[model samples]
Target: MQIDVDPQEDPQNAPDVNYVVENPTLDLEQYAASYSGLMRIERLQFIADHCPPLRVEALKMALSFVQRTFNVDVYEEIHRKLSEATRDLQSAPDAIPESGVEPPPLDTAWVEATRKKALLKLEKLDTDLKNYKGNSIKESIRRGHDDLGDHYLDCGDLSNALKCYSRARDYCTSAKHVINMCLNVIKVSVYLQNWSHVLSYVSKAESTPEIAERGERDSQTQAILTKLKCAAGLAELAARKYKQAAKCFLLASFDHCDFPELLSPSNVAVYGGLCALATFDRQELQRNVISSSSFKLFLELEPQVRDIIFKFYESKYASCLKMLDEMKDNLLLDMYLAPHVRTLYTQIRNRALIQYFSPYVSADMRRMATAFNTTVAALEDELTQLILEGLINARIDSHSKILYARDVDQRSTTFEKSLLMGKEFQRRAKAMILRAAVLRNQIHVKVRGGGTGAGAAQLGTHTWAHGLVSIAVPSPGREPGGADAGQQPVPDEHQHVRVPAGPSRRICTPYPQLPALLEEPLGSRPRPPAWTPV
Candidate 1:
């Protein structure tokens, strides 16, 4: 029998969800002002939800800004949240005296008026789109669709805005129009929290010939590229691909990063910095983050994040992590960065720990703990985990409180590898010799009787003895293995002479008959070549 357990209920399988921000040192007015449109209201609402200290202030800002748009539903929702937060503040033990100010009453008249206005505008846009379609003008029809999308977006109908924006794609007549349609769709997709759709449209916008061929030379194209990169970075961040997200954000052009509708320049710096620190190695951090000319402008926007990256690169782990901790509250208040804060922090800490012990043969657990600002037991646990994961080639002595790098026997390893290579060479050489012998002998299985049965098969061999005999035979006047000045007597033509075949054997044959044997075949039977040894 198997018991099914919920992953969320299993501590080991569950993700870290302790994302809360308290006491953020953010200037709400300045931060909110950096963004416009739905982005500002949404970011404020998110900050209000996660941060208790700034709940009422954030909600009040969102409530006020939301009124400028025709999103009556969101206005009511923000007001409701503001009222709750105000009541909670009043009931707190350290509550201040009432300042004689209350949240503004629900604007029913404005709500009704805005709803009617939105409906009228939507209908008018629909009518215009139909008229454009009837006229069969592609550009006008595309503009009509975009106008409808804008109207839907203003009224906080993300679904309808997305549909309208996507509909414009079919009517696009040029690369610029297609890019515009894709950007509109991407914006709505982001607002809808549809990250995959955002990434898809980002890719489409980037792949357009106007953007791809023009590169970054054109100011207008550069701005669009920056927006595309930032959107892709957010999608990658949401997907938990920290390295890819870092690369995307780092590619964004600082001067052209004016997409306040999505994120601020300061956000690019923070997101790119933390991601680079978490995933990039020392050389990559130095070469890409510290020395990058384009991204330096972005880094200048967030000095704190810039300092954290420098500190981490300089091997100042304790101070760097401390700064990160101090900034956690503010980062958690961010809508995009909040969910990944804990995971990124953990990865950065782990990378630091791994780098700390990399250059040392052995290190004391106490010193490492102090460097990481953690307890000795915790440090030991982390080291053990790294060792198990093969990130660190080291071992620990529990009683001694020391971690030692494992010794590798290079000489034995080298000898073993050489032996294996030698064996392989010998095997290959033997195979080559066998193959050459088969080809030299012309040996093969010959099939007879035109039959497929094994009984009809016979071995056939062709001797290459004629060429060997011709090369081995010397001139008749000169004796084999004898100097020209030798005084040895020559045997008579009819007499049998003993010729040395080798050191251990001799053959008796008439001197004149030996030359005749070399010119004739020996009875069509396979035999060894006649020996004439030196």
Candidate 2:
């Protein structure tokens, strides 16, 4: 097949060809210097215009001589020009013969041959850096490898691209260059889903002292590390190392929070799965439960994770409730609830009941009614005892007043009046206690029977438990001047009382004057004075 050459289609043969190459090399050194200066000024068009016709081999040789004898200035200039020229040619249309032009085949072959020759010359220059010695030469070699790797990467040859990058990274000496190489390796490993390799490279990158000393690690690096950690956790989960997996997943979830981008649905699902695994493993829970310190640390690290975790438990609340109901001895509650009583109560009241109570009641209201009846009966008995004690105290006071009033002449009238007031107060107190007990029982019955429902009764119970813990548990340490070292302090005690080392001497102090009583009767008859002590 004969290929026709078209003069109009040939970029090199265009009218601008003369404008592109008008300068010849008379003083090679001076010309190279002048050309480098033009390039430094970013006047690429001038250099292109002055350079000779496409003498590919000669141009490369001149560039090498300029690099060796003069400076990199000329070499960089030539590379810049050549790159621009190549881009321009690529943008131009392929050479085609015009109608009736009938160009010769050799001419067309010569054009393709010339372009290939130029590319080969540049390729050789790129490769020759490998033969040079020293770190400076190695840097050039690294650049060449990087350029080649980019070419391969752009061409979709990931394996070859990785190989080139790996070679370049081996020669990297600067911290910046090393970090770049590590990042490149990480990118490829991630693309390939080589999780183990990704972790290894990340570990190496992070272990570098220079990288460690950096005030802030790069976000991309942190994100990659977070993802690898999560993947490692998933692998452990797959291997049935549930405890280890939970630890890893928890760490990953916490770390991922640093970069909000990692909190995708996939990661959430992974976190949820780890939590589910932990729930199934009783040994893991037992090991973690006693160490309040560890639980605190977990809370600090993953505040959001607890909600998902509790939700997981909420799904299993029915099972826990069933266990509680079936075991009359409260053994199951002791096992699961006592260690985490405060948290369990809150979860039951806030989350578990809110989500499951309706379904539970719908399934069987009779069971709830029975439970409520038992609780109400116990509360009623306690209230009855309290009322009876109050009545007995009031009766004793009344009897004492009557005996004193009969023996003393009009002097015991104040005592009689005080006793009567005490009886009234006791009566009111008993009624209030009875009313509270009755109301509690009614609420319990309503909650259990699914009649007029006690909305959020479970929540109220949880709040009550929280309040009990808050009120009953003593603050961590004792205050000064309040309690003796050997004595246990009361829960509400805020200060300690200190006794001095001196002999026992009572200190007499006057009480503050009380305000005038506005509610007292104005015309009440006065009682005679009782016998005064001498």
Candidate 3:
């Protein structure tokens, strides 16, 4: 803004390296040239040697541009190869001044100060990236953190690595990078033996579109998914979730050219086949586990795995257990698999018991011992355990030395079901009654008034031959011969009757004794209580 030294007279000053970074007025075209082509590399070397603070900032700014200019893989290669070459220039003397104004020597104390200042600059970069509202810079920072996470992972510091990877994933703007970060997290989680977290990470990785769908089509991705699935299966097996373990192993793709680092084909077979043998029912074992395509692929990896499973499915119970016992040496040696050996064998034993008892209603414990190649007492103990687990619906006759399956009462079950239905119906009926009462109150009913009286008459259309006649007539509300303001009936065979529907109303039908009744005049001796209507 003011009169400054002329460009021709003043030193070139390392090609405008002294320009104000905050509000520079230098021609952007000239400054841009210094960061371009061969000049860019030279300037980077110069800055790294001379300005440590600016070097970190420049690495933060320029590395991503290089990564974009080439690619991630190439950037990684260049970073690995050329980083030290550039650092060597830190000790080299500063280049001759562009305008013959020799710059000060590279000061160790000044560089020491700049190196510390670089961290502050990077911290400022962190804050700037937060406030900068752009996806590109955010993704750059994510990738930066990803590299740091990878370093921590290599150092076996999973706690800090997980922290970095988690932040990297959250800052990701693209699905590709997000999936990469997820896989990183899963890797650390597995190494840490955080089995529960491994399952969750595997689930997330499997559901990701880039991973799950392409798992089979892409060899690398498929291998990774296979490993993940295998890890999850092992976790399940460790937890004694044999059925879930079988499903996970059965879903894995093991035929790809790429193989997992931890799980071998044999490992897959043993874990998958044993889990299947333990949890699968007869039909499921044949259709989904032993004969399924995935299991078949696993079989090719290790035929013995399938053989053991097929033996169990065919009811060769003793053979299956014997095979597992013989192969214990090799199987128990696997690092990924050795942990689950006991539980797997226990499951095999339980399956053997289940298959052995399939056809028996009341098998003697001695015969069971013969079939299983064990003592009668051992067989009895196994049966008791099975019964207690609710796996077998039977009771042991300790005295008779026989095991009897409890006969299920279908009638009792049906009766209980019917009772439940009736209770539900009763509750619904009461609700309907209340609803009906509410509706009834909402409508008005009109009734006609009675003049003489409200009368109810019964019409008789049938007459039996030689049948004695019985007639019903309305009675006075007040009891006759009792203390009341009512008249008593004359002494005759006629008796009073009451009809609930027609209280205080006349019947209107003639009396059955009409012709023979009224033989004496009512007004003579009795005078009809002096108020009777004649």
lDDT on C-alpha atoms for all candidate structures: 0.81, 0.40, 0.57
lDDT tens string, model 2, 1-534? Answer: 999887546453222223333334333333234332212222222333345333332344344443332223345555555555445544558734335222112233434554465456447745664554334676877777777665554333568768887888767878767766766666565445565665577667666665577524666545545554554554443333545555654444333333221222233333433343334333443344322342334454333334434443545544444443332222111111122223233333233323333233122223322333334344234323433654211111222221011133455888898899999998776555534432332212112223332433221221222112110111334322336534544433321112111222111112111011112233331321121121
lDDT of 1 by residue, 1-534 (tens): 999987636464344455566678999999999999999999999888888888888898898899999999899999999889888888889988867447888889999999999889888989999999999999999999899989889999889889999999999999999999988988888888899998999988988999999998899999999999999999999888999999999999988999999999999999999999999999999889899999999988899898998889889999999999999989888888887887899899989999999999999999989988889999999889988999899999999999999997989999999999999998776555544432332323221223444322111111122221001222334433347423433332112223332222222344544444433443432432233433
Per-residue CA lDDT of model 3 for 1-534, tens digit only, reads: 888766644242222333222321223223223333222433343343334334333433344444323123323433543455344434458733234222222234543554455455456645654554355578677876776665554333569778878888767776567667777777666556677887887787778777856757777777667777777886787566889988888878757523333345656777878778777888888888766876687687666666787777777766767777777644543334555666667767887787777687777877777767778788788889999998888998888788887887989999999999999998776555534432332211111221222221121112212332222222323222345314434333223222112212222223443222223333333211111111
Query: RMSD per prediction, one decimal?
Result: 14.4, 34.1, 26.2
Q: Which pairs of residues collide in candidate 2?
A: 481-496, 481-497, 481-498, 482-496, 482-497
Candidate 3 positional error at 247, Å? 1.0
Clashes of 1: 0
- Model 2 C-alpha RMSD to native: 34.1
TM match of model 3 to true structure: 0.52
The better-scoring model by TM-score among 2 and 3 is 3
